[model samples]
Target: NAMEGRVEIFMRNEWGTICDTLWDSKDGNVVCRSLGYEGFTGVPRYNSFYGKGSGRIWLQNSSCNVDETSIQNCIKSGIWVHQCNHSNEAGVKCVPIRLVNGSSIDEGRVEVYQYNQWSTICGQNCSDSEAQVLCHSLGFGRAMNINATAFFGEGNGDILIQNVNCKGTESSLLDCGKDDVTVQNCSHHYDVGVKCSSVRLVNDTHEWEGLVEMYDGGAWKGLCAQNWNTAEARVACRSLGFDGSTAVTQPFKMNQRIKAKFPTYFDCRGHERNLFECSHHRIPVKTGWYSNDECTQAEVRCIPVRLSGGYSNKEGRVEVFMNNVWGTICDAGWDSVDTRIVCNTLFGYSYGGTKVSAGHFAQGVGDILLANVSCTGSESNVLECKHSLMTDHCTHSKDVAVKCYQNIRLNDGKLEVYVKNEWGTVCTYGWDDADAKVACRSLGLPRYYDLKDNKKLP
Candidate 1:
């Protein structure tokens, strides 16, 4: 409760809450810092998020720069001020993540400040992806290594983060689907240890992977793909913030715009911490490469999946990640079963997806990675779905797209229910879950329509 509660300030021989007027993150930081906390991660709760408070309202329009010494150092109106009530009292929450009992501050057993107590994370589902989030959140470059075997020893407090699954791009560990804490199955022996790196991923379009460039002599330079291998890639990807990464190394085609290259050849034993840690020396830079030159330099796909060219993140062209790059799926055998897998892979669950017409999300470029795709509606990933022997001349025009978590009867917009040869919406005052279920049955589909609330029109 000390970490988060109604913020009350003592003034003029009485304690009184501050009014939630013009309260911002800077103001929240001043409050948290005043209470003996690093307030960089301060979050303000505007509408009494920690519940209402009693007593006279003190300050209003509290303005503070984040660097202020305390709430008292901030500018405020006269005490016992007016114009606000208890329901609008100011509140704040601060996040402070640190590592304990480590060789250094950047490496050790992970502990997070929460609920007025320091908590340990269970190593149950902890991995490199989750480590990336922890490192990034702590102002480090990326997670270089994670030891689920209690590498830096363990902690004694309650285990708050029992399970974590991250895409390796989240700014905070809390954002990356830290599973519900109602169930706690952890002990000190199962605690996690993490090591962060100063290495950064730059010049990348996607989240997980990008061009292999090294900063030497003060400028970023691309790595020459001459002697690169999977061993080098494994180290490089992890340095760039991938968790336990098994990288897909490829000779990335580069244009003439790339002026400089990493002159040294990296020869990794496949277990080094980073590319620099690997043995390396100067290598001859090959010339005679023009535009569209393959392997002019190297790039790594740190294993990623993304939806592209769609209105929403979930509703998009089904571009599967395969062979170190993102490619499309052919609509040849794409169906409801296949859609379910893709939707579930992108999202946790699908409410019976329906595949749209070909090129509905726009014709995709690059290889048609999958074709004759089929699934039994049970697989967790679309790529795992049974399919033909790869794309047999599948064209871009046949690129597949899906609309997930929608009523199976609707496609893109409202007023769309596939009635008997017509299109219209159900208009009724008492229209609820019952009516929608009945409508689905009439259309010969299952119940639980994956419905969203529709506004009642005038």
Candidate 2:
């Protein structure tokens, strides 16, 4: 019953509809404001945009000044003064939409408001031209891509708009051509999505370090540094394809005249993938934190690290990615301390693990970048340890490998292994009861099975 369409009014214990002969924004504003909206800035429609209503045509030739509180108080001819039909039913748009559940503000599934509820748009027959118009309306430069299969994520609630067609230059999506109000034949799986290039880090030469700039409403704005912390920096760094944030710097002085367009305080746990994923507090202009001397632009630095050539994210042939090249580390003096640093860098936590040599996991083919490596167990990254830049003594056969304990799991009482991010049963070949006992002890569980029973466990 909340779907878009014809305007209807209830009076004298009977339902009646309004005629479109004299309907406009003034009358529509009165209807929307009476329904608890702040003001109606949306367009008024004729020819039953929401579908024709079946009832008495009560109001006709109605006119309302913009200051009217309700449609009943508006200047109108006597009730049912002229002949009319359901084809002349009136409709109004009271609310608009914005994107959500995306990795950035510029990407996500499309959602619109109707009947006091948020709804998704079906991607069926949605085109790139329409997406371009939508991006422009949201203060974006243009749409880079349009995903029609709910690529970001499936949405909930009603499917509002469908069969949208645009010429790629419209100011708003409401001005686009669409199918008449009818039951949609699509589901949430076919929800529409758009990716826009609207955010960037500026004022720095490095890709990982810069002042944040974002587009909002209809203008580009900068953020304030009242409560900016490392956790918030981590999200920004991760959004730029870094492992995490190492530091948050406030070097630029605050400009009180420059309005802060984003949340003032961000509460992140250092694991969110995007800035919007964190809880935030909007700072009013009158707040004490908005003072000219207190405001400053925030900048961040991120650690550039990644794991490669291992079956699982936890256990990998140690590789350092820098300057856009993937290179391996020599196994010379590789030990638990060095492996611990790698695990900490990858998983954001330490897991004391075993180190393997002679290409135990697999040989890596690249520059034997580092050799004679030594770590103090307190190093945050492998590169922080003492190591040689290049070595000829070690080959791909001596490439370093790690089997972190965090990558193993027990499923249904069976010792399962995870490699390359996939879970599978561990091979029992050459495995003895001593190995099983150590595994059980690591998990803080009693050893209940012998070596002969290991094969049956899986």
Candidate 3:
């Protein structure tokens, strides 16, 4: 069973015999690879494990030289076989698949919204850096939990394919995808998972305003390991525009690996231009007894933060301070529904209809945290808003700020259709009738209008 195979393969609704011409171990490798196997364990020979099938075409003559993707491409056309119906199913069996050097989903790894499905990391070109980030996201410390097989456990259900192409500069494993320019296969293993911990790093600020020291630099320092608390973490988080610190890491657990720039100690609030613009203070060793190694190795806790642009309503304007500049909210596209949510968030909207309104309600252009906010009538704040595009020549001065006009009732059911620059009400008046006929038939609703004319008025 090492050089000859007597199996009838189906192709082009015909059955044929595969000659031994151009058959060798290299061709065998192509077949195995196409079938999701690592490589050819042995060549097809006499008494080899052959596949039997009931289909359109059977017994294919194959010639393989390159990394063929499917078995159909490996073989040539063969004789016509009897058509196969569902009553008879094609069956094929081979030696048990063994796990090799690869990555697989762990026993209890659950993706965010991907449900309970598990996948294997494609083996085309997986690197140790990707392994490190993936391990950390899964709650493992660093790349200490790298595995070459489905060691954690075999995944159930459909085998998902995750092609990870790391350039070594990606901050996280998920950022990588199957790039079209260069294609590779990670089908070496059927299932893959990762084991991770929360061993992450924490840095000082976002933008590097001046001569701020980096992680290993001895000049700047962090809080001593002496009984760090959530309050300290909260303060540090707020300083960096974060909602609060999610977790605090103790000594011996911090990531001090200086390999990659990020996986560095601070994920900034916004995509900052530099690293020192954030607000957390750094400990400068002016005259204190400190060494470079001492500063880098000292037990400093990390404050993982949930971040956002901070905004609050004052008087009648939504105000936010960023980059040390305080600015007001613009209401260029603000409306009652948008303001209703804002009122509920800022002040309880128990007064109902009279609590929030929007009109001449524009705030002087402040630092534009955001602009051109399109509300589907379900959002809370402009900071949390999303727009179609950045808009043309958008300066912070052209940014609209919002402040809810007092006394407004929330309107839900009625659709707010845009017709002009100012939101004019489409009165229920003349909402019926010939008006619709003029609009519809004017635009070619002849069939609909003809049907109405063919019948009498009900």
lDDT of each: 0.65, 0.66, 0.36
Candidate order (lDDT)? 2, 1, 3
lDDT tens readout by residue for model 3, 44-96: 33212244333343323345555665555665544342322222222222222
Which sections of candidate 1 miss by over 4 Å? Answer: 39-43, 49-51, 76-80, 94-124, 127-458
List per-candidate RMSD values in Å. Answer: 26.4, 16.9, 26.1
lDDT of 2 by residue, 58-90 (tens): 887677776887787774677763466776677
The best candidate in terms of lDDT: 2
Candidate 3 minimal-lDDT segment of 10 residues: 208-217
Candidates sorted on TM-score, descending: 2, 1, 3
The TM-score between candidate 1 and the true structure equals 0.30
Instruction: Quote model 3's TM-score.
Output: 0.23
**Top candidate, metric TM-score:** 2
